[model samples]
Target: MSKTLVLMRHGKSSWKDNLPDDERLLKKRAYKDIEHVASAFKHCLDKDFVFKSSYAERAESTAKHFLKQLGIPETHLHIESDLYTFDESSLKAFLYTVDDSLDNLMLFGHNPAFTNLANALGDQYFDNLPTSGLVMMHFKNSSWKDLASGKTILHLFPKNLR
Candidate 1:
C-alpha cells in the first residue's frame, strides 16, 4: 500500500513582542492562506486522514483553520507537543511511530524543519517552504517505517492562491 504524506508549514504567525513563542497565534493573512490551500486539496483527503500539528498555538491554529475550511471532522486531528521542537531528528522519530493503518497523514508545523522533511522524503527539493506552504508526496513503501525519498506529487504555496 502506498503511503501519502502532506507536510505543511504553519501559517504566518503573529509576534506579540512579549508573548512566548508557543503562544503566538496566526495572523489574518495566514487564515486567508490556510483557507485557500486547504480548499485546494480537500478532495484528496480520506476518512483515514490524520491531521497532526505542533503544540504551539500557531501550528495548532493552523491545523484548526485547515480542518474548518476542509470540512474534515475534528476527530482526525492530533496535537503533538514534540512537533514544536522543529528538528529533522524529531520529525523522523515521530514519523517512525505512526501506525501504518493511516496512510494519509497531514502535518502542520514550522518551516526549516517542515521544508527539510519534505526535501528528505521527496525527489523535489525546496529551499524554503513558505508560510502555509503545502507539499504532498507518495511513498512506495507500505509502512511509514519504510518511508524514504518518494515522489513529489504536489507543491502548493500560499502565494499561488493569492
Candidate 2:
C-alpha cells in the first residue's frame, strides 16, 4: 500500500516576548501564510488523514490554524511531545511508531528536523523548509517503518504563494 506524508514547518514565531523557545507565539504574518497554504492545500488532503503537531506553542498554533482554515475540527489534531525535537532522527523514530493502518500522516513541527526529513525522504532537495512551508510526498511502501525516498508531489512556501 502506498503512503502519503505531509510535513509542515511551524509558522514564523515572534521573539518580542522574551519567552522560552517552546513558548514563543506566532507572528501576525504566520496567520496569513497559514491561510494561504491551507486554502491551496485543502484539495490535496487525503480522505483519511491524521494530523499531528509538536507540543511547542508555535507548532500547535500552526496546526490549529491550518485545521481552522481547512474547516477540519480541532478534535482531529493530535499533540505529540516527541515531535518537539530538532533532530531528524528523533522525528524519523516517531514516524516509525505510527500505525501502519493509516495511509496518510500530516505533521507540524520545528525545522532542521522537518527540512532534513524532507530532504531524506523526498526526491527533491530543499535548502530549507521555510516557516509555514508544507511538503507532500508519496511513498510506495506499505508501512511507516519502511518509508524511504518518495515522490515529492507538492511543495508550498509562503513567499512563493504570495
Candidate 3:
C-alpha cells in the first residue's frame, strides 16, 4: 500500500524570560498561520492519519491546534520526546517504529531537520521550512520500515500563505 508522510515544523514561538525553549508556546502569527495551514489542509485529510509530534510545547501546540481545526481525533496522536531531534536521521528512525496498518502519518517537528527531511525524502528541495511549514511526501512502499525518498505532493509554509 502507498503511504503518506506529512512533516510539519512547529509554528513560531514566544520567547519568555523564564520559560525553557521546550516550554515556549505559539506566538500570535504562529497561531494564525497554523490555523490557516490546518484549514487549507483539511480537505485532503483522511481518517488513516497517524499523528505524531515532538514533546516540546510549541510542537504540541501546533499539532493540537491543527487537529482541533481539522476535527481530527486524538486517538493516534503521539507526543514523543524521541522526535525532538536536530537532524532527519532520528525522524526517519522514528518513522520505522510506526505500525504498517496505518498508511498516512503526520509528523510535527523542528528544523533544520524538517527542511532536510523534505529534501532528502522528497522530489523537491527547499532552502528552509518556515514556521508552521508542512511537506507531504508520497511513498510507494507498503511498509514504513521500507520508506525511501518519495515525491513531494504538497509543500506549504506560513510565508506561502502570506
Candidate 4:
C-alpha cells in the first residue's frame, strides 16, 4: 500500500513582544489562509485522514482551524512537542513511527525544519516555505521507514493559491 503525506507550516502569528513565544496566536490573516487551505482539502477530509500538529500555540491554533473546516474531530489530531522548533530529524523519526494503517496524513509545524524535511524527502530545495505553505507527497510504499530523499509528488504554497 502507498501512503500520502501532507506537510504544512503554521499560519502567520502575532509578534507582540508581551506574549511568550509559545503563547503567540495566529493573526487574522492567518486564519483566512488556514480556511482557504483547508477548503482545498475537503475531499480528503471527508474520507477521514490523520492529522498531527506541533504543540506550540500557533501550530495548534492552525490545526484547530483546519479540523473545523474539515469537520474532523479533535481526537484525530496528535499534538507533538518535538515539532515546535527546528527539528527535522525528529520530525523524520516521528514520520517513521506513524501507523501503517494510516495512508493519508497531514503534519502542521514550523518553518525551516518543515521546509528542510520537504526538500530532503523530495530531492529538491525550496527557498523558503512561507506561512501557511503546504506540500503533498506520495510514497510508493506504505512504510514510512522506506521514505528517502527526493520522492515528492507535489508541492503547493499559499502564494500559489492566489
Q: Pick the candidate with the highest lDDT.
A: 2
Q: Which runs in model 1 stand beyond 4 Å of their true positions? A: none
Using all chains and alpha carbons, the TM-scores for the candidates as numbered come to 0.95, 0.98, 0.94, 0.89
Indicate the worst ten consecutive residues by lDDT in candidate 3.
39-48
Q: lDDT of model 2 at residue 1?
A: 90
Candidate of highest TM-score: 2
Residue pairs with colliding backbones in model 3 are none
lDDT of 1 by residue, 19-68 (tens): 89999878889999999998888767653678899989888888988998
For model 2, residues 1-162, the per-residue Cα lDDT tens digits are 999999999999999979999999999999999999998898886468899999999999999999999889999999999999999999999999999999999999988999999999999999999999999999999999999889999999999888
TM-score of 2: 0.98
* TM-score for predicted model 1 compared with the true structure: 0.95
RMSD of each: 1.2, 0.7, 1.3, 1.9
Error (Å) of candidate 1 at residue 105 is: 0.7
* Candidate 1 residue-wise lDDT at 124: 97
CA-lDDT, candidates in order: 0.88, 0.95, 0.88, 0.82
Tell how far residue 142 is off in model 4, in angstroms. 2.6
lDDT of 4 at 66: 84
Q: Report how far off residue 30 is in candidate 4 (Å).
A: 0.2
Candidate 3 C-alpha lDDT tens digits along 1-162:
999999999999988667987898888888889988997788777546888999999999899988988887765589899888878898888889888998998999899888998999899999998999998999999999998879999987777677
TM-score-based ranking, best first?
2, 1, 3, 4
lDDT of 4 by residue, 57-145 (tens): 99999998888887778888899887787778988888888888888888999878898888888765788878888887777886888
